[model samples]
Target: MDGSDDKRLDDTLIALRRILRATELYERELAQAAGLTPAKLRVLQILSGRKEGNATPTAMANQMGVRQATVTALVDQLENRGMVRRERSSTDRRQTHVVIAPAGVEALRSAPSALQQHFVANYQKLEAWEQQMILSVLNRVALMLNAADIEAAPVLTIGDIRQDRGRG
Candidate 1:
């Protein structure tokens, strides 16, 4: 109940803005450096680290905690860029797999490290209760911003969310 509280609020807003600005900058940098969006880069990373450098779109969606359509869209983009290819599963003809191409591997190698990787590393080093508290505060802030209903994947890109075809 003091004027200092108003200053605190301004500081908080500034901090949030900085985070937003940093994310936007990172997105732009990644695109310029690797010629790929965050989502597409993530798709390639997933396939690259997986067995045989391939996975089904449904599986990728689950791993990324997004919708199949979003993953499909990312896959389509990567395929167009010659970063990945689609193949029918030999075991099940009905299932198609997205396989990372040589270009995908090169792109991954060329891309800068993701901002989320730094966040995740630091987050994991925090105490469990600290981590939980940070999560609680972030969730509360989302609710305060009326963003609790928003569908966001674990990725930290500022844009290109496209999490759901129908708000996934």
Candidate 2:
């Protein structure tokens, strides 16, 4: 690429990285204020959003794009904290399902502000076409960055999976 093209790409990458970093910092602060690690808070967020009482280890692993062992460990930690509980599935005794406890629900509800609330509020104030254009550009940029890591799953947005599963 020419100098200008290279400079433009560099600038875009830097700006995107800054945005990601800011989001992470916000999440960390929010989780800390709620007495939870960022990872634990993420699990609580996922479980609280589910209308169904139990989530299978396989399902949660798939949702998080992590190995079953990692998901189990996360559940183990949360379970010990009384944020979640495990129950044997009625249909299949071998299947252990994870459910959010009332404490988990409260933690998720009371967790500190996320970037989504601020970003979405600002995004919603934009024109419909502008929102569409921004989404399109962002998705393209993400894909470009992930081109070398084709096996990686796309990042899951809040509510995306729930919507896909048709849960109310």
Candidate 3:
């Protein structure tokens, strides 16, 4: 590649690294503020998104791209903290579901999403076409970086990074 192309590539990589670092730091800060580990907080967040604020452990494991054992451990910690409760599924008595307690909802509400706030604040200022362009570029970049193959959940927590590495 030409020198200008090399420079552009370097700049793009640096920007991506900055975004990743910011997300990692924000995850730690959010976890500390919520008095929970990132993984635990992520579990609660996933539960909170469910229709009834509950999900089966297997489902959570799939959503988080982690092992079921990892999700069980997180659920146990959350239950101990009174943030979640285990209940037998109504449709299937043989299955158990993890439900987020009222405290879990409160914790999630109180947690500050700094990265989201920053992104939303800036993103809202962009024109509609600009927003679309940015989304397209980000999607292309994700594909270029081979992240498209990863089964990432919609949750914004950084807990998946460690889980991904563990799998590798």
Candidate 4:
């Protein structure tokens, strides 16, 4: 409404843009280093996080918040790369589980999580109250931006924004 309010809004928007840009650049670097696109790498990461390093396409779609068709395509790519294998579920013959191959695990290990390294290192240095305040503010900001419903995993990477927008 006033000059001060306008300035604060502009600054907030700029900071958000910087965060998005940095995330995009970091995603590109991580993908290049791992020799995989961000989306494919994400699929491998998700599979690795599973209890047995395996999951059905439907479950992966749910976890990644993408379409089943998208997960299927990613699985196909990973299979071609020898990063994953599709095995028919023993209990349910109708479903196939995507299992991460040894190579995939190696790749995951080799990929340096730049975002985590940068954020965690700095975040750990913050005071306890400062960390709590930051978490609270970030949660509030996410709610304000209508992003509260986005299913974000512990892993950090810029997800497919176009696909997410389609879901909305």
Best prediction by TM-score: 1
- After TM-score superposition, the amount by which residue 115's alpha carbon in candidate 1 deviates from its true location, in angstroms, is 0.3
Q: Kindly report which residue stretches of model 2 are placed more than 4 angstroms away from their true locations once superposed.
A: 1-10, 116-168
For model 2, residues 1-168, the per-residue Cα lDDT tens digits are 999999998998899778878755765566566656545666777777778866887887787776677678778877877999999999999998899999888877777765666777898999999999998987787688775444332232321222212211
Residue ranges of candidate 3 with Cα displaced over 4 Å: 1-3, 37-39, 49-53, 57-73, 117-132, 159-168
Which regions of candidate 1 fall more than 4 Å away from where they truly are?
A: 163-168
lDDT string, candidate 3, 10-70, tens digits: 9999998898888778777776677665566678788988987789999999988877887
In candidate 4, where is summed lDDT lowest over 10 consecutive residues?
Answer: 159-168
Candidate order (TM-score): 1, 4, 3, 2
Looking at model 2, residue 78 earns an lDDT score of 78
Candidate of highest lDDT: 1
Candidate 1, residue 49: Cα displacement in angstroms equals: 0.8
TM-scores, one per candidate: 0.93, 0.63, 0.65, 0.67
lDDT of 1 by residue, 28-114 (tens): 788888887777778888999997778999999999998898898888777877989999999999999999999999999999999
Estimate the lDDT of model 2.
0.69
